[model samples]
Every structure is written in C-alpha cells, then in structure tokens.
Target: MSGPFDGLKVLELGRFIAVPVCGQLLAEGGADVIKVEDLDGDQTRHNGPIMPFEGRQYFNKNRGKRSISVRITEPEVLAAIQKLAAAADIVLANFRPGMSESLGLDYESVRAMNPRVIYGENTAYGLEGPMAPLAGMDMALQALTGLAHMTETGPEPLVNPIIDYAAAMLMAWGVSTALYHRERTGHGQRLNVALMHAAMFLENNQLTHVELLDSWRGEFVRYLKHAFADGKTWADVIEHRETLLPHKVVRAYYGFHATKDGTVGVACNARTQRLKLMSLLGIDDRWTSEPGWMPEDAHAHADYVYRQVATAFAQQPTAHWIAALEERGLPIAPVRHSDQLFFDEQVKANNFLAEVEHEVLGPIKVVAPPLRMTETPLAPRPPVSLGKNTREILAEAGLGAGQIDGLFARGAVREVHETLEDLL
Candidate 1:
C-alpha cells in the first residue's frame, strides 16, 4: 500500500528544531519534502558534536528531505521560491515573526500563489499578543509558561528542548487535520502553533483551574506578586509554595529512592499498592492506612514515612527493588541513563532505532519514525548535506541546465559537494 502522503509535496523553510521536525513527520508519511536553506544552512548543522557543519541534530530532523540552497534576498532566488510555493500542496515555516513577511512567504503571499496550500507556521508566541514580535527559544518559553517554576529544583529551566518538540507535534497534527479538512471541502487554511501554547498544553492538567474549586490559585498568584514586590529570592518563593500543595499524599508513595547500588523510581498511587508497599516496609502508620484519618502534625508524619521508605530502599540494591516491585505488579523502574537504551533489548525488539549511511560519517544510528502502520510502514532515509539536492530539485521545477548554471554563477544558488576537511 502507498503511504498516506505519497503524492503530497511540502515546502519547508525552517531552521533549528520545531518546523524541521514537522517537515520530517510529513516526509515519514511519504510526502516529497523540499527544505529551503540559506548559504550557511540550518543553525543546528553547526551546533552538534559530530562535525563542523553537518551534525547529529541536523541528521535527526532533516532526514528524508531534499535541500535547496539559495539566497532568498536575491530577486531571482525569490522568484524561484515563489514558483516552488505555487506548486506545493503544503508550506511550512518557523521564521521569526516578521521575517516571513519580508521574504514574501507569509500566509497571505503563499495563499495568493496557491490558495489550496496547507500552510503550517510556528512562532514563539501566538500572532496576536503583546509578545508576538519578540523572539523566544525553548528555554524562554519554559520560563514564560511556568514550566521552570514547577520543576522540583524549580525556577530553573530544563536542559531538554521539550517545548520545541511539543510545538513540532502540534504543528504536524494541525497540518494533518488541515489536510483532512481540505480533502472534505477543497479548502486550505493556515495553522499557527506557538511554543508558549505547546508548553501550556504540556502542563494542561496543572493549568486547569476552575475559579470556584481552585480559589487558592488566585491567592497563590497574589502571593507570588507580593513576594516579587518584597524582593524575595526564588528559593524563598518556592519554599513558600511547597507549604500549599493541595494533595498532601504521603511523599513515600512517589519519586526516586537511592538504593545500595543505584536509584529506582517508585510510584504507588493506588490504595492497594500503597498498602502492599507499607507492609513490605513494615510500617503501620494509622494516618496513611485508615480512611479519613488526618494526622495532627501532617508535616511530621510525612517526614517519618518518607524517611522510613528511603532507609528501607537504601538498604537493598536497585536490582533488588526492581525485582521486588515487578513481582508485586507495582509501577517501578530502575533509573537508567539515556545511553543504555542504545543497547537495550526491549528497544531493539521494538525497532526504536534505525541505521543510516552518511557520506562523511559512514553508518550511524538515529531514532526511527515514532508511529507504525500495518499497511504503510515507514522506511528510514539518510539526510542530505547542505545543497546536496539543489540541482535535481531545480531540474524537477522545470529549470533548464543553462538557467541553473546561471543562478550558480550569480551566487544565487549553490550545490555543495565538499569533503569533511573542506567543510571545516
């Protein structure tokens, strides 16, 4: 069977992660994706550890796509881009807020060229807000959306670019939905996905605050404002916030515990699991087991339970706890570093990784397509280097050999064929 997007064509004007990842998703579904880049290529090409120009980050997200390198500032190059846009079924871009308008690839311009084109856009903030014009990356969005503040060692940003990945998923979903809507009614619409919005979506459960039921939320906000006004440190604010947790579940039931050898995560949320864990730990705290029995000193009782669990777990090795928890059918796992997954039996059995040959790096492993389909399975494709497919794409766009050479002569377009040392 053919893939879902076998005959679709996508034009991607993106750098870094979010929109590039969205384009990758469409390509995995068997769309023909053409990525437009400037002379230096995507920033990630220079950011990773493997090479001076083409690196791991670039390989991960730009796979299964063709690259067309051009200086869009030149009129001839802009015209060529317009021609490509006119022929595209979908156009994706994650340029800064006003950069697209300047380049004439904004939704309005692209719509004028191809009204039925599904346009997917990513921005740091939504289009119609005070912060719309401002530039933001993953860390900034995390701070703006309270993700940083909510972490355990909080008021600090997470090292991972989770917000970018979330935005990419949202963009791909929106584009797929748009494709469906177009199939039904022959209409195309623009999709705007913001990193801030994605961050909020990631915290949906915590962000849902009903005014009547969550009255404490407003009071907490007021307290934060007061704390800011009083020049209190972030540590002080977090310390104050800790005292106001609504669900005062005994701390022993959740989080990581250090065993004799390594750390293991334990989550016993259900009553039965909690009881089983308590029995194994040899504890009979009436405050936790008895229904509707509130401890007089809640903090003191919680501290005691937590210490007991911690001490008991630390007495044994991580493997011991893993075996014990699995036998009991409780939710538990040993803390394993990310590198371990590359050699993990379960990951290999599931085909979570695929090997692709790189011109410079030889064979390397990368994450496989996240989804699977019974009929139309995705095959891995190696990513091309900067401007690697420029000539072929221009030929497909109906540019003659002489015209393409002229563009190359004028420094408007380029096809890079370089050695590793030359790239460096």
Candidate 2:
C-alpha cells in the first residue's frame, strides 16, 4: 500500500529543523521530497557523529528523502533550482525574512513561475514585524514567549527543539491542507509559520491570561507551603489571593507516585476509580467537594489526603501497583526511561517503531509515523546519503550529461561518491 501523498513532489531549500522536518514528514507520507543543499551540504551533516561511522542524529530527522548539492550563488545553479521548483508541487524554505526574496526563492517569484506551487516558508520571528529580520532560534523565542519563565530548567531552552518541531508540524499540516485545496480548486498559495508563533501556541493557556494566571499560580504555591510546611499560614496570605481561586485547586487522587521500587502514574479521576483506589489502599474515603469549604481549609484537606495516598503507594513496588491497578481498570503505568520505549510491549505490538537497514549505518530503528490510515499506510524508506540524488535530480530537471559534468567541474554542483566514505 502507498500513502495519500504518493505522487506528490517537493523541493526543499532548508537547513536545521523547521523546514527540513516538514519535508521529512511529507516524505514519510509518500511524497517524493528532494532536498536542495548548498555545495558544502546542510549544517546538520556535522551536527552529531559523522556519517558511516555508526552514530548519526541526522538520520532521525532527514529520513525518506533524497538530496542534491548546488551552489546557490551560481547562475546555473539558481536556474537549475528554479526549474526544479517549477516542477515541484511544494517548496519549503526556512530563510531569514527577506533572504528568500534576495535568493529569488520567495513566494511571489516562485508563484509567478508556477501558480499551483505550494510555497511553505518558516521564519525566526514571522513575515512582518520589527523582529522579522533579526535572527532567532529555539531558546531566544522560548524566553520571549514566557516558556522559560514558566519552566524550572531556567532560561536554557528545552532539551529538545520543541518549538522548531512544532513549527515544522504546522508547516506540514498547512502543506497537506493546501494539497487538498488544490485538488479541487487548482490553486496554491504561500504558507508561513514562525518559531515564536509555535512557542506561543505551546504556551496558549499560560499566555492567554498572563496577570490573572500569575496570581493564581502564586496563590497555589503559597497554599502548598502553608499546607505542607510551618513556614507560612493561610490566613497571612489570604489578602493577596482571590477567594474563588480556591475552587480551581484540582488536586487529584490520580497522579504520579514513588513506589517502593520505582515510579508509577495513575489516573483515578472518576468517582468510582477514586473509590476503588481508596478500597485498594485500605484508606477511608475522606475527600469532599464541599461547595463552601474555605480556600485555606480545602488546601489543608487536599494535602492531608494526598499524604495518605502517597504513603499507601510507597508500600508496594511499581510492578505490583501496576498489576493491582490494571486489574481494577484504574488506568496506571510505571514511569519508564525513553530508551525503554524501544522494547515496550505495546509500542512494539503497535509497530510505532520501524526497523530499517541503512547502506551506511546498517540495521536501525526509527519512530514510524504516528498517523494511521488503513487504506494509505506509510512505508518510508531509510534516509538517503547526502547528495545521493544529485545526478538523478539534475537529469530529471532536463540537464544533459555534458552540462551536468560541466556544472560539477566548475564547482557549481556536486555528486555523491560512495567511495568518499573513507574520507570521513
């Protein structure tokens, strides 16, 4: 079976995460994605361990795609890229605000070349604004959007480039939507996304009502201190808190807990589930959603109740708790390291992780597409070597063998050579 985008062709002029990840997703969904790289190649080529020596982080990000190397500064290379873009159904780029226009790869120019082209552009700040021209990445955008202030990890960016990945997912979704639209209307247009925009999207709830949220969050923290420690009293902080905010205290009997051997998170939010948990732990059902309970009293009650729950959970190993909870139909699972996901029974059974044999890295596993459509199942090929399709792409763009050789010889283009693996 093939994917929904089986016949779609895409040309990618991108580096790093945002644009490339979108191309990667499209390629996985069965679009023929071809990356157009500068002569030296994408910066990610040296990002992790070098290729053909075993370890490569790039493989996870750039799979199921072919690539061609071209010097964007050369007239011949620029013409070649234009011809390729005109033939493609979609073009992806993550350039600084006006860089695309300067390189003649902008939406208006490419649309003039092929009005049906879906041009996807990702910028650091966005298309228009004072911040548009300035360079930005994952960290700077996170801090600006209040994500850093909200996180305990300080101003350092999240370990993963979550905003970059999110922006890419947005771009991919836009491309899919545009493709569907073009199928009926035969028109395509520019789609834009920004890292800052993705950051804000991620921080939606927290960013929406900043001042009120800040106050509520601060009140929650103070409640915790008063309820758990003797450092402060609820009455002392009552003046600074909204009386109604106490109703928002959603402490659940369902949450993560440290078991005797490991950690397990449970979900017993339902009344019956909570009752079952109380029965299992041999604890009395003492929680009440008493409508008029004072905020101070409610916090104290929640803390005392949770302490009992935690004490009960710590009496058993994680596995024992999981088995006990699963039998009761109270949703529960042990906390696991990410690497353990590779061998997880449910993950393997669902085939969310795919194993492929690479020409350079041998056999390996990659996260398969999370999306499932029975009729159009995706079966992505392994990631291709850098510039592996240089010759093939140029030929398909209508360059003769002589012209291709001349371009290569003049340093405007490069072709992959498998024998060069020794150089690494």
Q: Which structure among the candidates has the greatest lDDT? A: 1
**How does residue 172 of candidate 1 score in lDDT?**
90
lDDT of each: 0.86, 0.79
List, residue by residue over 1-424, the lDDT tens digit for candidate 2: 8888898999998888889889989998899999987776787776775543213666777788988988877887788888988889999998766778888889999999999999998888887888878888888887777576432223345777889989999999999899889989999999999899999899886555457445577656657556536544435444335453534343447678999999888888877788888888876545533334454565566677788889989998988998898999889988888989988999988999998777765677888876778998877578766678988998898889998999988978876554335444
Candidate 1 pairs with clashing backbones? none
What candidate 1 gets wrong by more than 4 Å, as runs, is 149-154, 285-288, 420-424
Candidate 2 has what TM-score?
0.84
Q: Looking at model 1, report the run of 10 residues with the lowest lDDT sum.
A: 148-157
User: In candidate 1, how many clashes are counted?
Assistant: 0
Off by over 4 Å in 2: 52-55, 148-157, 205-248, 251-255, 268-279, 282-294, 297-302, 419-424
Candidate 1 lDDT: 0.86
